[model samples]
Target: MPKRTATMLGCAVLLGMLMGESRAQTDDPSGSPGAGRATVWIEPSVSVGATLSSNGNASSSNGRSELMLDVTPALRAVLNTARVKGFVDYSLRAEYFLDGNSGNRLSNRLNASATVEAWDQRAFVDVSGSISDQSVSAFGPQNLTGLADVNRSETSSFRVSPYIRGTLGGLVDYQVRYALQTLNTDTSIRSDSTSQVLSARLGSRPVGQQLGWFFDASAQENDYVIGRDTRSDIARAGVIVSVSPQLNVTLSAGVETNDTITLQRESYNITGLGFDWRPSLQTSLSVSVEKRYFGTGYNASLEHRTGRTIWRYSASRSASDSPTQAGSVRLGTNYEIVDALFAQSIPDPILRAQAVLQFLANFNIPADAQNFQDFLSSSATLNQTQRLSVALNGIRGVITFNVSRGTTSRLDSLTTLGDDFDSNTEIDQQSWGVSYGHRLTPLTSFNAAYIDQKSSGSSGISSKRQSVSLGLSTRLAPRTSGSVQLQFGRFNNTAGSYNDAAISGRITHRF
Candidate 1:
């Protein structure tokens, strides 16, 4: 598909069906004639599948036996109004081979977001976008299915922000923001970027003050279509010490300037400390530390809850220049860490994102596979991450587990021609996964999963992957559904070792 991407996806589906039928025939200035207070939700689906492979073209030498054909169309939507909020999920797939020796494909997936409240509660606007099928070489060739096309690629991202916040008579607290971000790929194998940021803040008023104060400033720029252009700035000030009533603390200092690793412009000195603790109501903790100029940075998190479980932990280190968030350079999943552990039991963000997509569709889970795997970088990097996850949710069963580790390096040494930190100065990764479903009744359901990944580079290059899946899903009427699956995968590197096995089936219909 490319006749200008199918005419720009048919003019964005006819401009989103004429702006959703002109916003459902607009009207509703607080109601009356055609009283509308817009609300729209739509679900559309279509799927057809077939797959039988031993190595359908992800060939690692004389591997053949292909039978693939799959078609998919999907959409999920939500929009609510009074001042708008929106969400969308989209999909598209087409694959066909039937032994024509592999090749005939198209893929797409998207996640979208929107928010607008133009002047209510102090002006706002935010937008988001995503598309995926990454890995343009983090040591190339790795797969776990999307039906083969190994060494992946198809990345997209977008973001927009506009902001203003108020409170100056409630004794100081203010905000100002601006953001723009972008990333794209259709293959140039990485390098396409744009980022801009402007920020402001002034604070005080930590619930009837106990010694509070704040000041913050920001500036950032990253522009690359082929590298070179990075700038950063920061300013700070702080104090907020309520050391009790469940704790609070902070202290900060300022100054920063950058060029992201030389070619002039370097200035530093910034210090920080942060804290917050919640002692109960199911536990919480937060932490922060900073002493920048690439040396010491930190952010920490912990959350706990039980009565059917949810536990999470996090750790971080900064400076990852844009790919529009998500552990920068795209990372974060297990369905956004169990939808942020169901935010204190679904505190409505559209019903906690539809109860985390019906709890990952009753655990046939693979909302982008238990996290961490993103590659394609163009300068500006420095990260260190850690994760731990757990989820339970029972009755008819659900379980999940996760583990993670990360490291990356290169904060630009002035465009070291063509990515991967110009021959790995650093790169290390690790991942883990486990899943189970079980609800063999109420219209079937039983699933299983296992995952693993490993990577290393410091110019010694390395790679590894493993996957296993089992599935069964039912409900064959009332807008139909069906599924069947068996899969296996393995990959290794130092340049060799590959394995695969598969069986698949699908049927879906909905409107």
Candidate 2:
């Protein structure tokens, strides 16, 4: 670590400890009495580890063995109160190349979310930001997007949304929202963008066995710093019909207009139908379909909780400047969500253990995006993405399998999946992977995964890849743990084929 970084980090540790100690002696239940009105809590930890790599640079003929040392420190803070609840997770990683095939490298990642309440609680603000690096290949060690090529770049994004939602009276409810999103990159390999969205809705919420009507209007503008810009507007009116306690139907009609050529700057009519169904307390499903001048688009999501297994599924077709969220994608907090859900479903120890097993074994790469490998382009596109995933947990162990497929085209290529891909074109890709894990003993466990990915680029070339990994983890101490891992992969394309393998071990101590 740099001298300045070390000095600043030391100060942070001291401050956090002092604050924590002082607050513990304070009289207030919310915080330390003498700490005044500080609502933010911080926890930081440091970790150092060493690894032996068979191929550190992930090359073919030039593979070399070496010993690597790495230092990683992280900080996490949480805020929970009547008005706000959120957290920030940040980490700094520094790696040293002892064999010197590669130079020393250091990188950091930060993810944070903050929500604020205002206007006497009628209005609220949501803020999120991230800075991270990603490999060009969507499935690389750093590229979980699973949709790109073989390169690495740093991407950062920030978003701020503020909205007011409240009922005007028992007869009507209203909401107004505005959002600003900015994307930045440290390198010139990608472009920057700023997006603004403004929307409003006036509706009569469905209650009991009643009919409700709603009016909606929204506008969005996207500016690509190095490319063309887009402007879009939408207006709609809809009605909800409640057929029963477990079912509701919505019908809507609208007009859409945009100045972005990708979506055809033309004006189009929008017709849509959406439904929410809850047949039982254990299952829920929602689906929406719409017809527009550009094409047909749909979004659907289903979730079910059962005694032996948990399930989640979602599919969507829409327009997006980028397929992933916040320019980088990671699997959402699915495991944690499942844990929380099953926590309420039953108290059976077996089921609880199964849930825990599933969480530990099936932890996945964030699939918020299509796992796309495409370079970040400034152009917008109307594309389709489908994802299906399931996990089973039991005494046998935990196993998870899922596949994400995407068909992308430029705004102008919406008519068909393209045969040629370029910095400005379209492609089709299917990526899938599976992971399994089971505890071998009380304090040790083993896990393994296999992934097969295929993609058809605009260049009319196809590439396929397969990767496999196995690892074992165990607790080393009260605040320390260790793991050993082995990974192997094969890649074949028009260029040639290559195989690479690596094995490494690391121990992390938290303080």
Candidate 3:
């Protein structure tokens, strides 16, 4: 299918299903807002700024200095109804260089997701989409600023999932789900692809029993616009036991067949063990281990919250084939981190989210700056990743810290041109960041932050980038604000090294 036609078809299907479901439900008789009726929020804002950069092109050596003007108009919309929940944040940024040394540019950024209960307790649908700037190559030049660069490209992806659930005469509970996803990029270095997954599960429906069992099956296929298609199928059966009020254990055996490693399909036995532990309301731990066709795979995570702090840690190793899944790994933003930290104190999810957003905005913190991102690839890979994060809130200040490391190894021998795995067998990436914000006055705030990232390929290519910044923000008036920032950065790699310095001021008005 053509790209544009596929996009339109996906949108039409999502809209038709959502509209059909909306007509089937009636308004709540209680007359209370958000109970059954739709509650919507729309926020629009614009910002203008001028920046002076010592290195505008982000070149490795002998870069030219330039002065640029930037204007960004952004909108955030949130919808809440008895049957649907969704939100979208979008921005359009325009840049013009005053020195005539570089051409003008325009870019778009968006993030959105929605879930609809189409058939009340039996059927549902999920839709999500995103457009963002990302690096095309892991070995290319790296930068701290969100400026236009030759190595960066606009990437977008969409997913639609619809599923049904019910029970069979008080004997077993079952669910069947189908998901379709598409990925595209502005640059030719990365391949656009579509993925389809169909999965089903049947489990014993127990009222108060301590033991249960389940059967699972799934088939997945991925087709690339540039390379050969890949497919996989798996079937499994598992038994679950409640060890105690706070712990549960599961054991499973299965078989999987796939053509990811070679042209011919191969079969392998699968064995797995897993446990979930939630000793208290403030903590949770989950661990799973499995022996698969590629190798031994495992996942573990721990989360704990205190009155004024939160800590999270996770580690995992698995085989990944779809670029959409690989690129979706995220460490979240400052707002999300702080929101999770306040869950113990605030209890209410909606209230906590609003409070966190307000607090970050007041302190001039960048709420959308993620700690790490992965480059896109078409070939299959064995990926191992680890992440740790913590947030602390005090009476007059807030601090957050995050760190992550990951390694990707080629799983297939086929040489896909322009793929990261084409020349190197393995790639390693690591990043860490820390930020502090303090209330200087009732209406003014101060913030400081530092971030560092490093990447290395087994083929003897490596790059490192570091940045430090300070800023101050104050409320100019109602629905208006102004801020100023100063930043310095350093970049080094096998090619060369460069240093950058920048200062900028901006004003924003909300409506």
Best by TM-score: 3
Model 1 lDDT, full chain set? 0.75
Which pairs clash inside model 1? none
lDDT over C-alpha atoms for residue 239 of model 1? 91
Instruction: For candidate 3, write residues 258-292 as lDDT tens digits.
Output: 99888888999999999999999989999999999
Which tens-of-lDDT digit does each residue in 1-511 have in candidate 1? Answer: 2322432343354336434643563446577766743455566788898888787666677677778888989887666555656666778988887788767878888776666666877987666667777888777766445555667788877666678999998889899988766777878857877677898999986785678989989898877777787788889998988878888899999999987888788999999998999999888899999999988999998988877788888999997865553413222366676776677777656567667766666555656564567687876788899988888878888788888899988877656657677888889999888888888888889898888988899889898888888999787886677888898998878888778888888887877
Consecutive 10-residue window with the lowest summed lDDT within model 3: 323-332
Estimated TM-score for each candidate = 0.34, 0.81, 0.92
Shift of residue 79 alpha carbon in model 1, Å:
2.9
The models' CA-based lDDT, in order, is 0.75, 0.64, 0.81
Question: Higher-TM-score candidate among 2 and 3?
Answer: 3
Better of 1 and 2 by TM-score: 2
Candidate 2 residues 315-380, lDDT tens each?
998878532223222224344434535665645433453444334533322212222344444456
Go through the candidates in order and give the C-alpha RMSD of each one to the true structure.
21.5, 6.9, 3.1
Clashes of 3: 0
Order the candidates by TM-score, highest first: 3, 2, 1
